[model samples]
Every structure is written in C-alpha cells, then in structure tokens.
Target: MDGPRTLVVSGASRGIGRHVAMRAQAAGWRVIGLARQTDAGAPFEMRACDVADSAAVRETFRALRGEPRLHGLVNAAGIASMNLLLATPPETMRRLVEVNLLGTMYCCAEMGRLLARRRGGRIVNFSTIAVALGLRGEAAYVAAKSGVEGFSRAFAREMADFAVTVNTIAPGPVETDLIRHVPKGQIDAIVARQVVPRMAEAEDVWQLVAFLLGDAAAMMSGQVLHVGGA
Candidate 1:
C-alpha cells in the first residue's frame, strides 16, 4: 500500500529535521517545514513560527487545515542547554522546558487533533539519549526529554484507537550545532562511549524518523526508539 502523501516537520531549518524534510520530499511526499527562520536553501514550504508559542502553533495548523490529507508530523523543534544542577538558573531551566517539552506538547496537541479527525497519521517526537545515559551537565535537558518520552507514550495510547501512532526517538551524540560548544576531548570521549566508536550523523537519525513516518512503521507506537552506536 502507498504510504502517507504529506508530512509536516518542525525544526526543519537545519540538522536532523532538515535531513528528514529533504529525504521525505525526495521520496515524493509533500513536505511542510516549520522553523523559526526561513532558509532559502530549503526545498519545501517553510513556515516560520516558534513552536513554543501555543497561539502561533495553533494558527499555523489552522492555516494548514485546508490541505486534503495530513499524514505525518515530526516534532523536532528543540533547545539544548548544558549546565550543572546547582549552577543552572531557574529561568534557563524554564526556557528549556518551554522549548523542548511545552513546544512539543503544543505541536502534538494541535496536529493530533487534525490527525484524529482523519482517523490516521503518525507523530515522531524527539527525545535525547541524555535522558537515558544521564550526563553530568544536562539536568534540565534530561528532565525535559524524559517528559517528552512520557508524553509520547501517553499520547500514543490515547490516539491508538484512532489509528494515530505516536512515538519518540532518543538520539545520542549527533553532529549538529547542538554539540558545537562541546570540547574536542569531550566529543571524543562521547564517541568512544558508543559501541560504534563514532558520533551519529544527521542522516543517521533521519533514517529512523523516516521509517517511523512510513508505512512500514504502522504497527509501532508508544515506544521510544534509541539511535546510538550501542
């Protein structure tokens, strides 16, 4: 059977989300990319909005309601902050939660409603391997990602009877701007910790996301798929 014909990917200006959007477009799906900035190089329709703002997300979805069929949603808009539990400021922590967790909730809530009306769709939420591995300076990030895992599972259960599959992808050490601040030695140490002895590439994570949004992943839902060399 043919898979979904349309896909909506957030954070598509760069990194894994960009890769996913490009790959999905290449595979003949109509792609709509949501990001805070517009990149002239982007190959799909770029919608500028901060997913952290509930009103903006709702307005974007409302504008997209005219489309005949919306099949997939990738919640990839995220913000990363690294700080010790004692050193992290209250506002910083709140910002991380707002962007990584609340933003995801807003996107999922809005998109899930549309998918529910159609009786079928897929949602791929982004989590982090830090949530599982427990890094030293990622207290806020870990907490937010952990929340994302729980949220994805619960939402998946709620959407199951409607044939909407919601899943989370917990990726480890991908080479993106998110890691630009890490020391070279620290980067090497992280790669060594992985069984593959290398960091994941943007495309590496995108492949799994593509699978989840594709027909082959119809049976999978409410699960967190970890993408790491180990």
Candidate 2:
C-alpha cells in the first residue's frame, strides 16, 4: 500500500520474474532479485541464490535482516516437466517437486515470517494453468503447481490477521525458456485453444503480479488467479 517499498522476487534472472522485478523498480519500488545466476539488467539489488537450498535461503534472509523491511514477495522460481506418468523418471519427478513445490514453500515460509513481523505484506506465487486444464504429459508439473496453490491458500489463511496477503497466479502458456523444450505442435495447440489466439507474454503476467503487490489488490487474498488468456 505504500508508495515506495521493498520486494523480494525469486527467479528474477528471466521470464515472468525478470519482468516483475524490472517493472516493480520502474514503479518506484526497491526490488531484490533472487536466483542462481546474476542478472545484468536487474533494476535493483541481485542476490544469487538457489531457492531449493534451505540453508542458503535462510542465510540469505538473515543477511537481509538489517536492510529495509520487505513489502512483497514473489515466488516465481519453477521447473517444468512433461512426460507420460509411467515413462517419467522418478528422479525427475522428485527434482520437479524439489524446485517447484519445495522451493516455493521455503521462500514463502521465510518471507512470510519476516513479513508478518512488519504486520503487512503481500506474496504472489506462480502456479500453472495446466493444473486447472489438466494437460496430458504434465502430470508431474501439474501436481507440483497444485501443491503451490494449496500452500498459498493455507498460508494466506494463516497470515491474514497480520495483513499479509498470499495468492497464486496460474499462467497459461507464456513465452519463456521453460517452454523451449515443449514440442512445437503442443505449443501451437495450446495457443490455438486460447481465446486470444496467441501465447501469453511475460509482461502480461507481470502486470497481474504488480497489481497483486500493489495497494489496489489489498482486499484480495488466498486466490488462484488464472491468466489463461481464455
């Protein structure tokens, strides 16, 4: 709700996370980007962090304790998986959960604790429309994203009294590196199914994230907003 605030955005090296961090800075918010790689174009401070690493994440937050209090958190780090359930390697599925589900949970827990101390903050988590649309060959991804959704809702409930809002953004088909490995035919089919008749852009999703983190969305919480372009 404040005019200028600090926001911690995960996966800010690229894709929707990158756009959100850049846009937030442009809007006068101080942005902190967390990723495994440094981003040359990041508008604010950049911290190379692997969200999947619990110890590293804890240390990162501890190091930031003396800085300005965080006003928002965006959990945008994620991994994609697409394969027949029977053919999908068990290890691959485990990794997917580790990165997508567990990573988000870790960030939320740490960030939520800090935000609660401030008595007000916002959290925007990344989910997937695949969880709602039930795309084939995406059982693992869908499951992980679904876990994110559930976690966001429950976390929202637990943090509401503190004025910390938590919500999930379920994006459809966004043009990002994560989708590069997806078959072209499948990508085309997904686009064809959209009412917009084109892939969702990272900027498009970033707008929603900005809104959620802004004062205009203060009344909302525990919602799974679907940016399916449908």
Candidate 3:
C-alpha cells in the first residue's frame, strides 16, 4: 500500500502559502506547513518557524528529514515592499532581502537535501512579475525576487542529477493580504500591464503548482512560469 505523498510549504499561515497547502491537501498530499504561528490551525502538520531565521529553518527541516518519504516542497515564504530606491528605508531593504531571498535560500537548501535522497521530487518557488516588468516603487522586492529566479534556475541543474525538478512561478498580482499594503493606483498600473488585467485567484496560481507537482512535469525544470498572462 502506498502512503500519502508529503509536501512542505513555508509561510503556510496565510496568503499564497496557505492556499497552496489547502490545494495540496485536496490533491491527496500530506502537507507540512511551516510558519511563525504556533497554532497555525490546519488539518495538516504545522511547524512553527521563521523561514528568515536560518537556524529555525535548519532545525525544522532536520526534523522533517526523518519522515518516511518526502516528495515535494514549496518555497512560498516571501515579503513584498513598494518604495522608490531613494525612499526605501534601510530596514525595509534588509527585510525584503532577508525574508524573500534568504528565506527561500534556506528552505531550498534544507528541502533540496532531503528531496535529493528520494531520487524524484518537486520544488516550486514563488517569484513576482515585478522582476520582469521592472515596476517602479518596488526596488527591494524586485531585487530579492531576481535572486530567487536565479537560484531556481541554477539549482534546477544541480538537482537534476538526483531527478529532482526545481521551477518558479511569478504571479502578476493576487488578491491576498500581501496586496493590501500597496497603493491602489500602483496596483491598477500593474493590472493594466497584464494581458489578463485581473486579479489572480488562489486557484489561478494553484493550477501551475498542481502541474509542477504532477508526474507530467517530470521533464519540466529550471522554468520560470509567468501567471496572470503577464
């Protein structure tokens, strides 16, 4: 009898991460959620963690490594900021780089190690359309997402030897709490740039996640998929 496939998703407390967790569970995967909330209230396993903190990520994955079978990972933990380069505060810059770049790196490092042993697994990461559009007032966010894209491409090749695929999904803009902070005018500008010209729903993003997690995507690696028709 085959047991349930396992997947780890960071930032699982809310936003895209939470939505992914729900979708994965519905797809019959055992989802392990990692977030900062101790009581992240969910059916699947929840590990309280701050992915930005390297030590915490290391520890969380260390425990997860002991699982009987690990099949997938989603590095969805990230932060967004909107400010001109001149106006962007140093603290915000540090946080953007820390939570977005460093967090993804740390999760990828630990999860990649475990998934490699499986000889077959999937790793999906989140990027943003800003990285491609060079959107104004998002210098810090764009820089961090650029790092994620680069890391995903390079790491895909490195992990291929182990039959593990790594890919990134860059959503134009979704109706998540993450978007509430942005100015409405700026949001409208981004929407106008998309071919779809509409807010991305949770399912819109999950469609790609499901495909990437499916066996059909075995040959798809090192790709950066743009959503919302960007």
Candidate 4:
C-alpha cells in the first residue's frame, strides 16, 4: 500500500480496544473504531455499531467501504462473566457467545470482505487465557473465546489466498473493568499459574498487537500467541 494505512478496531469505547485505537492513531494509521456506543473524546473516528449484531456490522462496513488503504482489523470487542457451568443461566451463555464469539465472526466477515477486495490485510482477534487454562467458573467465557481461537485458525487458512492473515491473542487477566466483577482471589489464582506469575499489563498485550498489525508480521498467521506465559 502506497498511501496512509487505515485500520478498523472494534470495542473501541474502552479497555484494550480503546488503547489499540489510540496507539494506532498515534502511530499514523487512519483509525476507525466500532462499538455499541461512541466515545466523545476518542481521537479516531468512532462508529456506533454493536458487533454482535450481524446486520449492524454489515451496515457499518458498508459505510466505510470507500476508505482508502484499508489495511487491518482488530477485534477486541468482548464480554466475560464468571459462573459455574451448572449455575450459569441460559441467557448468560447466549450473551457470552453473542458478544465474544459471534461478535468477532460478524466483524471478521465484514472486514474480511473489505480486506479480500484489497487483496491483503491483517486480522487480530482477542481470546482469553481462561480457555487454555481450563479455568472453572468461566465455562461460558472459555467456550466463547475457544471459538475465537478455532475460528481464527480456519479463517486464516481460507483468507491466505487473498494475503489476509488471521491470528489471535490470548492474554491472561488484566486489571480492566472486564475483571472488575471477578473475585480477587480467583484472579490471583489465575495469575499464579502463569510463568510470569503476575496479572498482565495493558502494555504487554499491546506490544504484541502492534507487531501483529505491522509489516514484520506479514508471515505470521493462524497463530495463537499467549501473553503472561500461561
């Protein structure tokens, strides 16, 4: 691509998505953000579109079809809740799948089309260490994230012909609002299992994200890189 690169980041209203959007903009990429609600102070353009809604994702991407140099997508829009499998309500599991799994799929489908049209792009989807750790009390969350990992690998293979690389980041617990409701003891236990033995910092994950979105990672696809050394 000869012109300025553009990237779309989902879940940009807060947490990891917000950080990625801000940092990517600072790095000179034209950033477009998507979330259910818009952030007034966001430095990049923020679009209100819930990724879990397939129709909303289609419309959002349609609106951005004219963007030049569209180069990447970062799917960081996700939700998590802790509950034992038996105790978890049907609605909770459905919601988890909706936002965490289906959300990623919907965005990837829309962005995948755009990237395929351009003949190349990178897609980074977020997962969780819970899936790898087989953590109890988070069966639904783990299942949803597991789907993300599996889907990314398959999607990567399919998109390879178009030079579109798909990869995943599965980070251990971070002190984001996503974990605010989780018990401190449980969080500590999860951290203790990591070789690094500490809760992840936002920067730790962002560094990997920056690389995956950069030119150096062009050959890296269908990979699940875990942070915190879990």
For every candidate, C-alpha RMSD to the true structure in Å: 1.8, 1.8, 1.1, 1.0
TM-score of 3: 0.97
Q: Per-prediction count of colliding residue pairs?
A: 0, 0, 0, 0
**Candidate 2 per-residue lDDT over residues 1-230, each given as its tens digit:** 44468899999998888888888888888889999998776668899899989988888777766556578999998889789888999999998998999999989888878888889999999998788778889999888999999999999999998999999998888989889899889988877766667778888898899899988998999999988654
Against the reference, the lDDT scores of all candidates come to: 0.88, 0.87, 0.90, 0.92
Candidate 1 on 97-167: residue-level lDDT in tens? 99899999999999989999989999999998788777788999999999999999999999998899999
Ranking by lDDT: 4, 3, 1, 2
Which model, 1 or 4, shows the larger TM-score?
A: 4
For every model shown, what is its TM-score relative to the native structure?
0.95, 0.94, 0.97, 0.97
Higher-scoring candidate on lDDT, 2 or 3: 3
Largest lDDT belongs to which candidate? Answer: 4
Tens digit per residue, CA lDDT, model 4, 161-221? 9999999999999878899998899899999998899888888888999999988998999
Q: Candidate 1 — which residues are off by over 4 angstroms?
A: 1-4
